[model samples]
Target: MRFAHLRVEGQTTPRLAVVEGESAIFLDEVMRRAPRDLQDLIEQGPEGLARVRSAVGAAEPGTSVGAAEPARGAVDPVASDPAAPGTLPRHPVADLRHSSAVLRPAQVIAIGANYAAHASELKLRSETAMTIFSLWPNSLTAHGATTTWPEDLTTQVDYEAELGVIIGRPARGVHARDALDYVWGYTVVNDITARDIQFSEAQWSRCKSFDGFTPTGPVVVTADEIPDPQELWLTTNLDGSIMQDASTSEMVRSVAEIISLLSRSATIPPGTLISTGSPGGAGYSRKPPVFLRDGSTVTVSIGGIGSLTTHCRVI
Candidate 1:
């Protein structure tokens, strides 16, 4: 099943919901007590997920309270009917706004130079051990949200389209063969970066941590839905041109390898989001530089996952 964090237009808080085609089913409406967010649900493990599935199935055909009566106060989607313990609240998908699918993760770890072609084009080393880095939480943004950066701060803001892996269980010293088993879900990620700052700094974290830099989601697909993470195709469309296009199979280090390696040192806790690096064709490497200017719309898509788009504005 696909999941996302959504809030009503005027609502300031985000709630976890299941995405069904064009509609969204607020999980809290279905379960007796739903996990607060994606991170919360992930930490609950498989048993909690099973309950969510059961409740969502039961509420599928019902009209959401938000849909039925716009003026009615917000109801916890998972709240049981006072009269009936099994009843759930249902809402229309159109009535809600999306937030980053995964929120408040323990940390955001990113793999760099993991793809041979990408490393070669960017002149980064791919021969050595995997290049890893961290993305600050401030960079997290949701799909359809406008991400803005100060013009004086960055003139060369570029985009790195990547795959995001969400860990479901605490993992330490996990083997590559077993690493995928610890994964909870997958989502499309746009690892936006400031090229000028990246080259000026010794470490990569700061340059990529600008507010709204890492735009993930649209939705997260369960691990069971994606049998092979390494075989999927990824592409980036800047405006109308296809800038970067490659397959996950081209990675110098597979997703499993990155997880195993990370686990060896740090206990990768549940809800840890790991962006699996981009392929060749960054805007900086193009013959004529292609930076995201004001009004630019960039989209990143993974074959099995979905397309995630971001609108850029330079203030």
Candidate 2:
């Protein structure tokens, strides 16, 4: 099942919901003890997801949410569901606001130069050792949200389309053969970067972790739905042009290998999102380098998952 953290247009707090077709079924409405957020549900393990599946399956149309009075100014399906299309009270995804796909994650780790083509274009000579870095939580933003950075801070803002993996359990010393067993789900990630700082600094955290730099999801697809992570396709569309196009198969190391290597030294806790690096065709590699400017819209898509869009702004 696909899941997202969404809010009614006028609401300030986000609510967890299951995405079905074009409508959203708020978990709070159908279940007695709904997991608070994706993180809450992940912590509960397989049983938690099973329970959610059952509740949504058994829910009847037009029934009251299991919660009390819908959190003040929140959608009251029983009383006011503005866009209930079917017999059930469902909200159209277009009318709701989005939050970062992963919230309160244990940590956000990113692999750099994992794709040989990407590494070659950037002149990174680190194929001998894996390049990994942590992304500041402040960078996390939502799909359809606008990311802004000061013009003085970065003039060469480029986009990287990556497949994000969410860890489902505490993984340590895991072998590549069993690494995928720890995945909770998958989501699309736009690893927006300030190329100028990236080349000057020794590390990547600050250059890529500016507030709102990382826009993830529109939704997260569970692991069962995606049988082979390496078989997926990733693409980036800047404005109306397709810029980055490649398959996850092009990675120097697969997702399973990255997880296993990461787990060898540290315990990768539940809800940790690992961005598995981008493919070639980065704007920086072009003859006339392209960069995100004010009023730019970028979308990153991963097959079997979903497309994530982020609007750009420069202050």
Candidate 3:
């Protein structure tokens, strides 16, 4: 099942909802004790997911409370095309505003130099031990939102398309082979960065964690729907140009390995979001060096998870 945090225009608070094709069913309206958010649902474990599945399955046709079965061999489509036709109190997804896919994750961890091509382009080495860093919560923003930074502070703002993995339970000393079982779902992430700060500082978080730097989700696809995370394709479009194009397969370390490695020293708490790094073609690596500027619109997409778009404003 696909889950999202959505709110009608003018509403300050976002409510948890299950998304079907082009429409959404707010959980509070359909169930008495609905999960307050994706974090709550994940914390409830398998039983919570089972309950949600049962509810969606039991709904009658023409109602907003039904689930749309994904077609075999097809990558999940981003937003449902044109609102679905039905009598149910279905609201058009297009009309709703989005909050961050994960509003209250336990923590946010990012991997650097996981993709050899990206490492090479930026003149960093991926052959060394894994590069890990923390992102500030203030950096997290919703899809279709605006991300702005002072041009005087950073004229070289850039975008990195990445796959985000949300941990379902506390993972401590997990084996690489069993790491996939610990994941709750996947979301698309645009790891926006300031090249100037990145190159100048010894550490990375501040350069990449500027307010509204990380834009995640249109929605999060549950783990069961994705059989293998390494096979997915990822791409980035800056304005009208396809600047970053690569596959998860190119990563020097796969998702499972990164999880297992992190779990060895620290317990990866539930609700933690791990951005699995980006591929080559960063604006900094371009011949003329492409960077985000005033009025720029950037979209990052992973095959199964929908595209995450962010409007850029430079002050």
Candidate 4:
């Protein structure tokens, strides 16, 4: 099942909802005591998720016996009747606002130079231990949101299309073989960076953690739906040009390996968002650089997952 944190226009708060086809089913509307957010549901483990699935299924049929009003803070469904599509409250996806699919994650960890081609192009070592860094929570933004940075800050803003992994269970010293077991779901991530700051800084975290730099999601697909995380494809489209094209299989270190390596030192808490590194073809390396300018629109897409687009603005 796919999930997202969405809000209707004029709504200040976001609610957890299950994405069904083109419509969204607010979980709080169907479940008596719903999990507050994606983090809450993930911590509840498989049983809690199963309950959510059951509730969504029942509501899809528009059955009245189990229908319930949304919780106090939840988005109000158009009608309570389970069987009536008219009763289902749905806003056009384009019109509704989106929030980072996983809100309040403990930390946002990112893997850099993980793809062999990306490493070579940037002249970074990919043969050594994985290059892992943290991105501040401030960087987290939702799909369709605008990302802005001061023009003086950096003239070379570049995009790194990545696949995001959300941790479900607390993990410590896990083996690569069992690393995937701790994952809850996956989403698309645009690891936007300020090239000038990155080269000057010793640590990469600060350079990439600018507010609104990491735009994640449109939706998060459950792990079960993606049996092999490494088999998916990723692409980055800047305006109308397809700049970066590669597959997760090109990674120097697979998702499972990265998780295991990190767990060896720190306890990766639930809801931690890990953005697996991007492929080659960053604008910086192009013959003529193609940095994002005001009014630029960038979209990153992952196979089976969804496209996450961000409008660019320069102050």
Give each model's whole-structure lDDT: 0.87, 0.88, 0.86, 0.85
TM-score of each: 0.92, 0.92, 0.92, 0.91
lDDT tens readout by residue for model 3, 40-107: 99888998877667555544446642232212122112121212234224567888899998889999
Best by lDDT: 2
Q: 1-315, model 1: which lDDT tens digit per residue?
A: 999998877777888888877777776555557789998889889978887777666654454455543332344343543213334555666677889987999899999988888788789999898888999999999988899999999999999989999999999999999999999999999999999999999999988999999999989999999999999999999999999899999988998999999999989999999999999999988889889999999999999889888999999
Q: What is the lDDT of residue 215 in candidate 2?
A: 92
Q: Which ten residues in a row have the lowest lDDT in candidate 4?
A: 61-70
Candidate order (lDDT): 2, 1, 3, 4
> Compared to the true structure, candidate 4 yields what TM-score?
0.91
Question: For model 2, how does the per-residue alpha-carbon lDDT over 129-227 read when each residue is reduced to its tens digit?
Answer: 899999999999999999999998789999999999999999999999999999999999999999999999999999999999999998999999999
**Model 2 — which ten-residue stretch has the worst lDDT?**
79-88
Q: How far out, in Å, is residue 184 in model 2?
A: 0.5
Poorest stretch of ten by lDDT in candidate 1: 77-86
Clashing pairs in 1: 28-77, 28-78, 29-77, 29-78, 30-77, 64-90, 64-91
Cα misplacement distance, residue 165 of candidate 1 (Å): 0.4
Candidate 4: tens digits of C-alpha lDDT, residues 116-138: 88888888999988888899999
